[model samples]
Target: MRTAKDRLRHTILFELLGLVTVTPLAALILNKDMGRIGALAVAISLLAMATNYVFNLAFDHALVRMGRPVNVRPPWMRALHAVLFEATLMLITLPIVAWWLNMSLWQALATDVGFALFYLAYAYVYNWAYDRVFPMPSAVRIKAADR
Candidate 1:
C-alpha cells in the first residue's frame, strides 16, 4: 500500500499531466474558446482529483483485502480498474458536462463517453507506467524476495 503522501503526489501528477494534454485538445476538437474549455476542464479535473485520491486508496485496500498485490496486476485487472474508475467518474460528470456545455442529456452522454474513453486509455497507460516507475513498497519487498 502507498502512503497518503504518495497518493497525493500521484493524484497531483496525474491531474496536471492530464490537464496539460487534454485541455488544448478538447478546445480544438470542440471548436470552442480555450477559456471555456479550459474552465470546464479545470472544474472536471478538480472533481477527478478528489475521486482519484479516494478511489485509488480504496482500490489498493480492496486488492490487499483480496490477497492481491497492488502493483502486480494482470492486464485484465488493469482493464477492469480503468473501466471502473472511468465509469464512476462518468456518472458524476455527466450532469456537469451537460450544464457547462449547454447540451442535452444524450449529447452530454456522448461527450462524457468521449472523455471517458480518453481517460480509460490514459488511466491504464499512466498506471502501468506509474507502477513501473514507483513500485509500491509491498511490491518492492515481493520483488526483492523473489531475487
Candidate 2:
C-alpha cells in the first residue's frame, strides 16, 4: 500500500504528465482554442487526480481483500484495472465534457471515449512503470502453512 504522500505524488505526476501530453493534442484534434481545451483538460485532470488517488487505494485494498498479490500485477489484472479506472472516469467526466465544450451528449461521448482510450493505455503503462520505480510495500501476511 502507498502512503498518503506517495499516493499524492503519484496523482500529481500522473495529472501533470497527462495534461502536458493531452491538452495540446486535444485542442488540435478538436479544432478548439488551446485555452478552452487546456481549461477543460485541467478541470478534468483535477477530477481525475481525486479519482486516481481514491480509486487506486480502493483497488489495492480490494485486491488484498480478494487474496490477490499487490504490486505484482499480472497482465490480465493490469488490463482490467485500466479498463475499470477509465470507465469510472468516463462516467464522472461525460457531463463536464459536454457542458464545457458546448458539445452534444453524443459528441461528448465520442470525445470522452477517445480520451478514455488514451488514458486506458496510459494508466496501464504508467502504473506498470511506477510500480517498478516505486514498488508497493511488501505484504505482512504469512501463509497459514508458514504460521
Using TM-score as the measure, the top candidate is 2
Q: Give the TM-scores of the predictions, in the order they appear.
A: 0.91, 0.92
Question: Candidate 1: which pairs clash?
Answer: none
Residue 65 local lDDT, model 1? 66
Cα lDDT of candidate 2 equals 0.89
RMSD of each: 4.5, 3.2
Per-residue C-alpha lDDT of model 1 across residues 1-147, encoded as one tens digit per residue: 787888988889899899999999988877888999899999999999999999988887687667677767899999998999999999999999899989899999998898789988998999889888978775533334433
What stretches of model 2 exceed 4 Å from their correct place?
Answer: 141-147
The TM-score, computed over Cα atoms with residue i paired to residue i, of candidate 1 is 0.91
**For each candidate, what is the lDDT?**
0.87, 0.89
Model 1 Cα displacement at 14 (Å)? 0.6
The 10-residue segment of model 2 with minimum total lDDT is 138-147
- Per-residue lDDT tens digits for candidate 2, residues 1-147, read 678999998899889999999999899999999999999999999999999888988998787778777767898999998998899999999999999999999999999999899998888889888888988777746457733
